[model samples]
Target: MAILTNARMPVETVNFHLWQPCNMKCRFCFATFRDVRGTVLPEGHLPRRDAERVVTLLADAGFTKITFAGGEPLLCPWIIDLIRLAKGLGLTTALVTNGSLIDSGTIRDLRGILDWVTVSVDSVRSGTLALIGRMTAARAADERHYLDLCDRLKDAGLRLKINTVVTAANHLEDLTGFIVAARPERWKIFEVLPVQGQNSGKVEPLLVTPGQFARFVARSRSVEAYGIRVVPEDNDAMIGSYAMVDPAGRFFDAIGNGYTYSEPILRVGVRQAVSQVTVSRRKFLARGGLY
Candidate 1:
């Protein structure tokens, strides 16, 4: 049976995640790719030319937008070449990073080739961040640093988006003020969700009930008045909704308790490879995946 009941929708957007490692230690991150790390992707990521070929496949597969994601995409030295290739192929290129490696110079470099960026900001409180393990080199970035980073992105004329994962550690904290100040075109709010092979065992302390997630959404609704679109994604809406490529460049989705992956795209091609995984267009739309 098709994973999505409707049975018809082209995968228009994909998160092409790099195989590199992240600098931060976010305990709730479901894309850690820990299972394949050091084994499947011994080199951390694909070679420069190979990575560019993957971009070509995504563009050829009819995807209109591609978000370069990672453990941290900025960590990949040849990311600029891939970005250039994706954009040249008429794909709207974007990035999802921790923002630790970004600065004015970096934003200036990305100003034209990249369309926007989504920085993960789970909590503004240092104490909350510490508990959630969103730290780099054992030091947590303060609220001021993040706000300044937002300003840099904005000043460069690059569109901005903020991604926040609401967990037990930060579900009660009010984020409307921060969201408003950030002035992002969109804000993605995700409830802490566990996934096998990634964060299954590590997320016990970060779990929150659906009710708590809803409460956090309600609290953050004030940002809408500031002309920011807030998109909230619950657990069900998240599963199988996204079209994602892991470090090995294979499609993957979580239709059941764990993820199901396809053969590498380089081997089979997009149509054949996508068939092995599940992606629900209905749930994708419901989760505000289209932007």
Candidate 2:
């Protein structure tokens, strides 16, 4: 079954980086490339009016889904408004969050606006989370909290998704138990990508070889029986398949060994901005990026 449905359009979905500030500092974050010098980080998200304009522009352009992502999307004060705007325009809306800021009040606030929520949970072991720089302390307690949040989200009648970044640190750790416990509708496993300006030099120690990644995929197959779909994305499979907009509202994509970006959609217009990036429709559909 399709995870979420959307109207047929030229660009089926777009992943917008709502902001760059995050509560946790994961060692393998690709968004670090946005600020290579680590000096000019965005102080806040796109202004509320501007964000609404962007959503209207995307919806007008026939984009069927808009996924609000970030260093931590929940940090954006206008996140719920954006989701509500996108849904109001007849678009399927999703949010990619670290799951740290999720609480009863937040979930209640998001009730009817969001169609999907993807939480980043790299490892079930607290030690692994600390090693990966995802948790500062009380790793075990944090894990329990994340699991409980997933349950609450499910109980609230929201479709749930889990995002696990596979790096050398946690690649070998069996995740079957975590998968079973969470019982998410979709579990996306991504191979750690090395961007030229971000984590390229510092992430070598945390990189996983293709053989190691394949083994992890093989082991993760056990969750299929539980009706949890596993979506795997190695580096090669990710390039050109995603429609990404940085925090500045510029569309960017991986090209060769570096990155390519377009003028901000607000300035050049969505069609012109999207024209600058290459999106593989076949790959997008194969990955179930479309509803």
TM-score of each: 0.95, 0.92
Error of 1 at 89 (Å): 0.5
Q: Candidate 2: minimum summed lDDT over ten consecutive residues — where?
A: 1-10
RMSD, every candidate, angstroms: 2.1, 4.0
| Model 2 Cα lDDT, one tens digit per residue, 119-224 | 8889877778888888643443356777898999999888999999899999989888878998999999999988877667667789999998889988998999
lDDT of 2 at 42: 51
lDDT of 1 by residue, 44-73 (tens): 677787788888988887789999998899
User: What's the CA error at residue 164 for candidate 1, in Å?
Assistant: 0.4
Off by over 4 Å in 1: 1-9
Question: Which candidate comes out best when scored by TM-score?
Answer: 1
> Which prediction has the highest lDDT against the true structure?
1
